[model samples]
Target: GAGLGDHIDRKEGQEHTFQNADPARRQLNQSFAVTDHCSKPLHTAISDRIAEGYTGTTAIRKDAVRALSLVFTGTHEDMKAIEADPEKLQGWLKANYQFVTQEFGKENVVRLALHLDEKTPHLHAVVVPLVEGKLTAKKLLGNRKDMSERQDRYAKAMEPFGLSRGVRGSKAVHNSEGWYLGQQQQAQKAVLSDLPKLTALDRINPARYEEKVQERFKFVSREKTDTAIELKRRTDQVRHAQASQHKAEQEAARHREATQSIAAQLLQAGKAGITLDSSYALLKAPAAIREAANTLFQEEVRKLADTHLKQGAEAYYRGIYQLEDSSKATREDYERHQKHDSEETRNHIAGEITRIFNQEIQQRWGVELSPEASLYKELRKKAADLVRELAKTILQELRKALGLEEPRQQRKSRGLGR
Candidate 1:
């Protein structure tokens, strides 16, 4: 609540420091208690109401959420229309307050205030989220689905003022297609309003009325056709997005298969490609033979890098499965694990790769250990990858023959696995 009270300061008739607030218009703002319990000086009033309603056995924490402050308003243009007309302004205020009270019981409502001092006139309502005598914001505010339902309810309540629910991230001009349906609804309602009067013969002459209705009916028909087209276009966009996702997933699978195939080729190449001598022989070899030796070494390092990357992916899934098995996994937990574990895995593999590469560089190049040379930094970084595949394979085979190792289960993915 530290920064939450700035917009609400004007509601309590406090001196507003915000540039957008108008001091002169401050007198025009009106605040009302839903049941005459929570009065002016809104904070104290709200605290008292919560003290009365909260039925938790233990003392409430100072940081516990006691209320939900909802600001009800429309787009700039929508509010502009309501502000220009005194009647609609009051009607909207009444409608918003009623909707709030209905949704959160009147007993829970602390204060409803209309602020006329802002650029766009809006109503801010504070309601204590005391559900069955317990203060639980989750029970009252719920999740996104519940908030969406609230938007539908609020939009319907504001329909009489010709305002529709706005698209979440779209501008009014871009929302024209959705607005088309709202226009058709308004026109249809106008015609419906005229029908009962026409039945009594007290309305305008039947001929003119019929003509007016016919034109409106034509407009509604055209709008309906446009709305249908818009719906189809949006549906197609969703399908296109889903299809693109599926295609990307297939591409990834193919990439993994290609990598495995290439790794096998590299392993085979390492076994049969080139045999090297001491540094003396290597230095004496022709440039062509030296180039082949370099290529062979590079392939071996790459094979290790690719293998470590695969293992890291398997380790990530293993962690996710462990969390899921604990039954307390959350999206935030998964994201945090990915962020921290990725950096750690990269560093660990890089160190192992650098260590093995350096040992080979010293032995094969006939150079004494000068591991800290600035020359090795770039070389270490360039070759930093995984491990020596040939040695790893030989050791694994030895362990299998001696019954010192068991076959590992298939590489795991997210969720539960034996």
Candidate 2:
């Protein structure tokens, strides 16, 4: 996409002096006259205009006329398809030109110039936004209605060409949504309402209260440990599946090697003039026994070749069977692993709830004397410890499942306890 100012140097009677404006902001103007008589020569006219310096104009003007040149760049994939048949591409452009003109405005839109001299083929569409004395950027952008409505219309317009709406970034959508102040107010209110309630006695007898809190903390830790264990189990199942597939592939390769070895042995025996036993030989063999034996030997050689050919087909079928079996086994193992992991995770989560109850609820109430408070605090601590241990175990299992090398253990001291 390119844009620049046009008519930088005003004609003798014009009021505006476009050349006096900043050169950085101006568009240099040039025009070309073409005859409609020859359809085949349209490309030649466009090439001449590009060479004469109309597309990349840089002249500045104080009150310059607004102009834009749009060039559709075909990707490598599109170029490949178009190169297969150039006429198909030409027809496509001719059909889509009307839509282009409608978007830029019928009067504002100029003739398209096709340039075929460059390494990449592209169409140059020159547009002058100003029709009469008025110029509209919104009109040129095809923003005739509200943005949402325009998007819907654009989707409909491009549907026939197998083109869908372009994807806008997630940030753009977020910014658009955040424009409304009411959403901000609702978000603030929701956050405040979710905060936990505090107790009055939390300020007094804090030491006694802390004892009960610690006990509950242990219980919550234990539950999280269980969850980590479950995740590890799932990872192990995936590894098992992969191992099974590898074994099947190895077996297949061995079978192929065995088949080829047998064929080679048979071919060697045939060349050595080895005779088959009488039971194996056909009748009318003794009269031309030497020639008949040779023919029989050649038939055996052909049989060996056929067996070698069958090995390839057999390997393919075996591979396919292994793939299907491995896929099914892997899926089953994963499902089982997930089930165990979820159970462990649930236990860990339960432990967390106990910790939260002790720390945030029971401890605040200063209920250390109560048997329930002490039990809860102990449970929370246990749960937290268990969760930490399970996490380490899960990490080890994940490495093993992913075929990563296990870490070496450090040597322990041989001395007895002091």
Candidate 3:
């Protein structure tokens, strides 16, 4: 970005400096040399070097590069370490200056400066492309192989200072921030566009509409599996990201298992080849169905949540404490996980609830409950709400399902009788 300038009227205490550092930081920048010969300004010195190097010929082209600019620094941490120690910093500067002077012959290095006020301390050098007493930029610039060997030489020189070559910029990154969200929306809209047109009848019947949507659009998108899974579990992104890798993987695995199990339930129902004309509401159903649901829920679902899921949540935190060292961040994370129903546990609970409801419908009434059915929606809502209530209001030791505390005190304060 530096332009060609043969003259510059520099302010006081800022001569022979090429760095465009902040005016406030100019005091922190050090100019080591500008031509081993005369004490001239930076631009004047640069022009003089190019003129002196040209041996033969016609006027020089205006666009010709007079010198190559080189910048060298190690990793940020390494540079900071050298800066902290005066001995090491001086040695590093010496090593770099020697490398530049040796590489371009002491006479051709027009200007050298060390910048220390920036986040990374680095050396900048300007070298005239003078070879065999003639201006030959190509000879000094060299082919790829020659340039690589030149890099190796510099690395060898800085070896004692623990400086090494930065990683090569060969990979082209294609995506920017929010690229995932854009891609997800595009994929979702593309997939959902292909559904068959709903009839007036279908519009009236949400069950038929929902079943058609489910049957036609099985995947969020088929182009990428990871993206598909991510879109399917979109609500879980923030929780998944802050959680440990092990916890995140557990959630993904549990999700896949629950989905597969629900698919198998549908398949089993289809294979039986029995169908009922309509559905029954679990609460407002015949006395027989209502009584059966409450009794079956007690036996099949509630017991599982009270024992296995609760203990599993507690055991999970216990294992977390054993494996992970104590830290303010980790402890905070553990406490948050305890407070919420973890996605993995949530998925398992939903799957079990769905399984029991499906079994109840198919076995007792020969009906397969579509998600749009009033009975299916009500039962699922009631079951999930029950779990939430227990976790929040907390009944007796059932408070432990959510890692709740102060049950007796809480109860008395809330006016629950003894």
Candidate 4:
């Protein structure tokens, strides 16, 4: 029996942290307990381990939790498998212990106890926050983000044991086994709170109340159907929008290719004029011919640069629209499957795409542009590089056609434009 001042809800025959507490429970013989700090009972060992670490901090936080006690169990059906096979139960217990030991370093895991006496097998573990030889509960398990990650990691670790993590951000709240049972009883009572009066007139006139309830139910069903239809209609609209967006993107790409072709033609003309001038200079032609050739070459180079910039800007905008469509498609696919993508996954993919896009833009234009850039600058530097390469090839072919000795000065300034 519980003594004075003890919790009234503390039911009898409940298992405690102490070993060999239940005499009638035959499965207690199979129960196992372990601790790294001491051979003492589970509760005492956990307390001592935390107290020892507390010496490192001069000012202890009042709201801090020195140790975290976690209970690991499975659904009733999963438990049934363990009940049918003792080996299966032991395997589960070992997996839980291993997870605790690995997560919080083996030295920081104070105690692990498997309770076989309970109807459902569960392992209770006490982990002290002792990272870098200091007591820091906040560093261990203080925030919701860390807690969510812990759940994910635990679920992955328990995957081989056939356990799953609960839905993230669910409405269901955690409570002790006793508290759950009490809540269940309270809910059963609450279900009848709106019962009609049991008068003789009411008993004979229950049809009126039944009709009202039926009408309310019919209204709810109609609303549900309307909402579902609206959702389907919206889905179709998005698909149509995506198709139109893709078509627009293809047309924009063709326009950009045409613009780039114009730029290439201008670059080729400039290279040809420069090659002709160099040949004339080697053949000792008049200064008038060389000067005219230089002017034409400069004009062609300027025109080529302008066209290239226009082409790159157009291409950048095209990429932006295509990327937007891709993102919409990703979101629509998730909606179609009715599977919610975690914000973390979505953000990670978005970040990766943004990084790759920025790198491509920087390489193509020699300048990093913002994601929402309305105007892209001229890629004169890249255009010049392309023109220089083509000029080298043209220069080599012209030198072969003229059969003239290459001038020493020309050879010295051979790769100057590049």
Candidate 5:
């Protein structure tokens, strides 16, 4: 039973009174009403309306039933599943809405609020008890038998949603919500009562618990320092790898461009009417062109390998040196912050490590590797093959123009193979 004083300061939309509330989760709270529940509390908003429409002239009893308050919710896991599915949440809300409306009439079912500002999803509903134009909570829900029947009916109504009735005929006595909470607190105290209770003398004794605190803090600080060092080490390794990859890409690009240039030179020589054995040849045009193409391509590859490999090695070692410098800075930072011996420092270090690993390292490694290097190598191979084929075709055509035949030894070998 609530005292008259209870209603003095109570108001609607004040959900902070509920246990297990988290202010951070207030954004997830939801409220709905068939009437004006936001501007007034549930009792006055719902019960007063039902009384106004009552057919009987008899005054409403002081102890008469007002709003029938109900809490509808499930365990954390079940609530999470329901929250994930809007259809499931809608179905659950609709089921409860139907039950309340059918039992108390649509006009009497006033307020339905869903609270997500707690550990689990739940709803608080107010149903004004108006039966056959009379306000009587006892007739509707006074006895245990009636209550159990109501539970059974609600359970059956919600069967489509996979809900079942709690254990029937259980011997647990119903108590007020405040009483239940008080009992829970007592039980918690009893569990913790086994620990040694400290006296006033023990509170001021520095020798008792101070050493344990300092030891724990020292252990946590050391762990954080080690973690910071490890993270710096891995970051350096990744930078070194990236530097080497950059060098490889530059080498591939340079070689590809040089190959295209050489092909262009060959095309220009052909356009100039320089025959294989023409005067343009250092000795003879045929041998001279062959030497130029092979030697130039070989020299390009040799130069590319030397330049890129040397630079990549140097960059890798320089990254290692930079890593050492960064590690020293991190160590100094840790020492500066560790003197405070606060939990915040440990948490910050942990969060930083997680951020670096998840964001930086993950993005770097998960990125799609560039195909330019492989494509360049492939193009180089194709270019070499094209040059060989073209050279072979030109040699055969020239021999024909010169009225030459296959050498006698080569012709005999072909005949033998056939």
Candidate 6:
């Protein structure tokens, strides 16, 4: 049968012992009591010597019998933690056992005992050849190549638990390059042996292979190349557009800041009780002071408008009660006052003019003084004539700035004249 063999002991009733086994020759050793099927009473002192000797010896005798031993050792602390919660430990062991069984055939594997006599926790697995045979020490215990691969596998398996390979002096196992090469050779042998056979035509089909190669080349050169170029172009376009928009936004923001600063200065001037005429003169002052004066002037105009409206409302209400004969005259007088007598009304109208001036400042770096201002009263009297002259000057400047086109009729007339 290929399954586990029936229990058999070579020593019989005599206690099985290996007190003289060399310690250096043993790859792995730890004390464990036999419990699953076999029972043996071995003295602690003799058992310890056997384990130590097995680890230290190297010589192998001809005709020596081969056997497998599996030892399960448990620490008092781990046993307690596991006993308190057996499901956790049991789950871990079950998964580990499955993995081991897959790696090493289950039939050749054996669990010798589960010992709870130690302070540290561990499991011992002893694997033997399926049939009774002389097991070389190199085979029973792993060689350098086998040990290295075993170590790599162990590290990979324990990675999920956050265990890593340690230094030479550390307890963690290390893998060597030689072990890796051996594993690669073993894998290659297995693969070569298991691969199915194929006919020459089935493996190489020349016409079909040529078609596939051409198709791949066309795909890379045409579709992939075009897509890459388009991607680069789109990326550059997007970056350029973003930069342009950012520049425009920054310029707009700066314009807004400048306008606000001017308004503030005007407000400060109004608060200081400076006459609008005097403030107008300050417009030609240094940039910082000019902005302050403009803000104050604008504020003064708004305040003047509010005052006029309030006063007009009061006068209108009072005039309605006057005698009928005097009422008409009083109403006419009130109307004139509302139209021009109120300083507040003049200031309110001036504020609107100042807003227009600010717009002009943005467009042409120039501000127009309101005709209603005390300093420009004479100009306000001939407003229509003054406006005509100013408009002509503005048109001339605009023509110069824009390089205005000549009228079609004028061009034709000039041609006829010529």
TM-score of each: 0.39, 0.25, 0.37, 0.40, 0.39, 0.24
lDDT, model 4:
0.53
Model 6, 1-418: lDDT tens per residue?
1111111121223221211223353333222222221233222322332333343244545444333444332224544565355575565455446555554445434343222332233454444332223334456446766756765676566444344432223332233323433444454455445544455766677667655654444434444434544465456556666876999999778767766765665788678654445434456444545656767755654454345433433333234323223323444443443354344544443344344433443343234555466634532333323333433343333344445654677658769434
Full ranking by lDDT: 1, 3, 5, 4, 2, 6
Error of 5 at 291 (Å): 99
Model 3, residue 120: C-alpha shift (Å) = 1.3
What digit string (tens of lDDT, one per residue) describes model 3 on residues 295-373? 6644554454445544444343334334232232344444554566565655455555565656755664445657786
**How many Å off is the CA of 70 in candidate 2?**
1.0
Give per-residue CA lDDT, model 5, range 262-339, as digits (tens): 466578867866443322322333443545644554454445434543333334322432322322334433333335
lDDT of 2 by residue, 1-418 (tens): 1111122122343312222233342232222222321122323433332333234344424354345556543433454455456686655465446655666554454445443333334455555554333443445454434555655565565454444443332122322212322443354345445544447857587666754564344334433443444445456546666776898999778666655754564576588664444322333223334345546644553453245323433233224224223223444443344455554564655454444433433233322223254545555455445444543454445444555554444112333232
**Candidate 1 structure quality by residue, lDDT tens digits, 1-418:** 3233444655344332233467888788787767665564556656777888888899888888777777777655778899899998989888987898888889988777788887677787778888898888889887978877887888899899998764543322443423644665576566556654457554648878876766656555555655665576566557666876999999778666655754564566568664345442335344444455556755654565455544543343344434423234455544454454454555555555556555655564554334685545644554333323322333344444444533445223323255
Q: Candidate 3: lDDT over CA atoms?
A: 0.58
**Candidate 5 residue pairs in clash (backbone atoms < 3 Å):** 276-285, 276-286
Shift of residue 113 alpha carbon in model 4, Å? 1.5
The digit string of per-residue lDDT tens for model 4 on 211-251 reads: 66544554444445446544654565566668769999997
Candidate 5: count the clashes: 2
Evaluate residue 8 in candidate 4 and report its C-alpha lDDT on the 0 to 100 scale: 15
TM-score of 5: 0.39
Ranking by TM-score: 4, 5, 1, 3, 2, 6
- Cα error, residue 8 of model 1, in Å, equals 3.4
Worst 10 residues of 5 by lDDT: 1-10
What is the RMSD of candidate 4? Answer: 24.6
Ten-residue segment with the worst summed lDDT in candidate 3? 1-10
